[model samples]
Target: MFIELDFESDIPIYMQLVHAIIEGIATRELKPGDELPPVRTLAADLGVNMLTVNKAYQHLKQLGFIQIHRKKGAVINSDEMRQADDEFYERLLTSLRPLAMESICRRLTKNQFLTLCSKIFDEIELKGGKC
Candidate 1:
């Protein structure tokens, strides 16, 4: 798996790591049973603290994206991959509402918004993503 981090982003570094991993899974870049690099290795690779990687892994586990085994390391949880609960979807939509509203306020046409979504969906599908 490959991930690049921007320490300057307003979003937390750990959260960025978690999101990157999930996107990898969603994009089918990481498959079921794929063993992720050990936390220390990834932390070193990303030049971030070990704790950051650990926190990201913990969050991934909490979201059912990965499972950590004593000897096997972290493996993608394919069965539940991208299967966020209703509450999660609800919260996601709520979070997106502000951005959508901002786009509309900026005078983006309905077709433009639709086209953007279509492009995103196409890109995800092309990547062999399940969701």
Candidate 2:
């Protein structure tokens, strides 16, 4: 698992860690059942606090992205990924709202915005991973 953290970014370290791990899973760099480094080890490697890694792991578990075991440590969720339900669609819309607003404000046409989205989807799919 290769994770690059931008120390200077405005986003919180824990959230960045969560996103990185999620991206890794999406790209198939982290397959189901893969074990993540222990919290203390990952923290030391990333130069972040153990609490941050723990928090990120907890969040991922909550989102059904990974499972944490006392002895097994953190493993990618081996079960089939959860299907997107209404709650997920709601969350997705909430997350995309701000970006949509920004795109509108920036005068990005609907087609252009959709093209960008398609480009991203293509890139991810080309990496031979399902989203």
TM-score of each: 0.85, 0.95
Point to the candidate with the largest TM-score: 2
Question: Model 1 clash pairs?
Answer: none
Tell me the spans in candidate 1 whose CA falls farther than 4 Å from its real position: 80-84
In model 1, how large is the Cα lDDT of residue 83?
51
lDDT of each: 0.88, 0.93
| Model 1 lDDT at residue 1 | 75
lDDT by residue for model 1 (76-106), tens: 9857555567989998899879878988999
Error of 1 at 73 (Å): 2.2
Instruction: Tell me the lDDT of model 2 at 96.
Output: 85
The numbered model that scores best in lDDT is 2
